[model samples]
Target: MLVGYARVSTQEQETHAQTDALRNAGVGFIFSEKRSGGSMAKRPALEEMLTKIGAGDTVVVYKLDRIARSLKDLLIIIERIEAAGAEFRSLTELIDTRSPAGRMFFQIVGAFAEFERELIRERTRVGMAAAMRRGVKMGRPTAMSEAEEAEAMRLWFTGDYTKIALARRYGTHISSIKRAIKRYRERHQPSLLDAA
Candidate 1:
């Protein structure tokens, strides 16, 4: 029995192409979804497909990355398939776990995948650090504007609004409101550094 799995990282990505490829490969049953490959928990279809496999069954996929986000994840899924007495196959990469050479090649591919991921991560960190060095902020923009923070601080000081109320009004968190209040107090109060 050939059971296929197809996946896309986002809803914007089309899965029909992968589905067609899997079907053309003579896969009778296919499970597909648009879900992030970042983690197993994010892909329910993949999890369900794994549970349905049995001895002599071959699990097919369009590509390795469609079923796995990282080398560790790929190995984990392959281990499960092997434990279930099933085989694994990738259409594009032409990997068939039934052969000894294919198994060794799969491991090599995993090593290359891990290496590629590390390179990407390193590049991203270096780029972010460079942006920061250039005085560019490198995170989500504040939900509450500076003007809104000032208004929240004023309202908080007037004792007219609660922390939760301020957060809801400004579409922010109670923690953010607290931080704004703290900043307001620090600015208003005389610091020891200023005294010195």
Candidate 2:
């Protein structure tokens, strides 16, 4: 049995090209989905297709990314297919894991995925370093002004109010107050050491 799976990120994006390719490849059953790959849990048709496929069957996909976004996810899906005693194939990538050459190709792909991740990490480190050298500030914009932060700190140090109370008085969440307290303690660590 040759089972096909087709997917598109949005309803506006057509699946005709994928379905047509699957039909041309002689798929006996085609399970189509219209959802982003980011939300794997929301893919009902994909889950159903996996449950329905059995031994001696082949699950065909138009492309690798159409089924899964990352190599980790692709490996997981491939592992599931193999565990079911079935084969996996991608039409565009020409990856047919049922064949010996296909297995070799998969290994190569795995190496490439690792290499790509390393390259991304290196590039990100370089970019961040460059940004720092240029005095570019990172992280989220401040939710509280300097005056508000000072007032919050003063109230907190007085031990007259709980963290929750301070947050309520400042019209902010408790989490914000907690973070502010943590930051203040870290900044004043030298003073604390001297006092001790």
Candidate 3:
């Protein structure tokens, strides 16, 4: 059996090209998903396909990066495939783990992928640090201003309005209102452990 796996990193992306290539390669069954390959635990389709594969089966992917985000992940996936008595194949890389040369080449490519990821991480960290030095704030804008949050907390304490009602009044989520109240309490009152 030739089982294909196709993945795209984000919901905005589509796996059509990968599926088409896998179909053209004569793959009978193809599992596809629009999810980040960064975490193997999160990709249910890939996990299902792996669990279904048996001896004499080949697990195929359009590209190596589509299947794994790092070398360790790639090796772990390959190990699982081989342990199931199944072969691994990458369409674009021309890698087939059935041969010794192919396995070596795949590991080499996986290593480079890991290195590239590390480089990207390092660059992002450096860029963010530089931005911070220039007084740039990261992350999403706050849902409410401090004064709004304070008023919300006050209204919450009065018990006249439910957290949901407070959220509606403030145009924020209930969770945001809860967080504001929690923050107010934390600042105004010390924890039991602190008193102890």
> TM per model?
0.74, 0.57, 0.84
Ranking by TM-score: 3, 1, 2
Alpha-carbon error at 157 in model 3, in Å? Answer: 2.0
Candidate 3 weakest ten by summed lDDT = 177-186
Alpha-carbon lDDT, every model: 0.90, 0.85, 0.91
lDDT at position 56, candidate 2? 93
Please give the TM-score that candidate 2 achieves against the real structure.
0.57
Per residue, candidate 3 scores C-alpha lDDT tens digits across 68-173 of: 9988889999999999999999999899999899999999988987898899999999999999999998976668998898878777888899989988998888
Candidate with better lDDT, 1 vs 2: 1
Q: Pick the candidate with the highest TM-score.
A: 3
Better of 2 and 3 by lDDT: 3
What would you estimate as the lDDT of candidate 1? 0.90
Model 1 over residues 137-160: C-alpha lDDT tens digits?
Answer: 877676688888887888888999
Please state the error at residue 21 of candidate 2 in Å. 11
> Alpha-carbon error at 76 in model 1, in Å?
2.2
Name the lDDT value of residue 156 in candidate 2: 90
Candidates 1 and 3: which is better by lDDT? Answer: 3
Clashing pairs in 1: none
lDDT of 2: 0.85
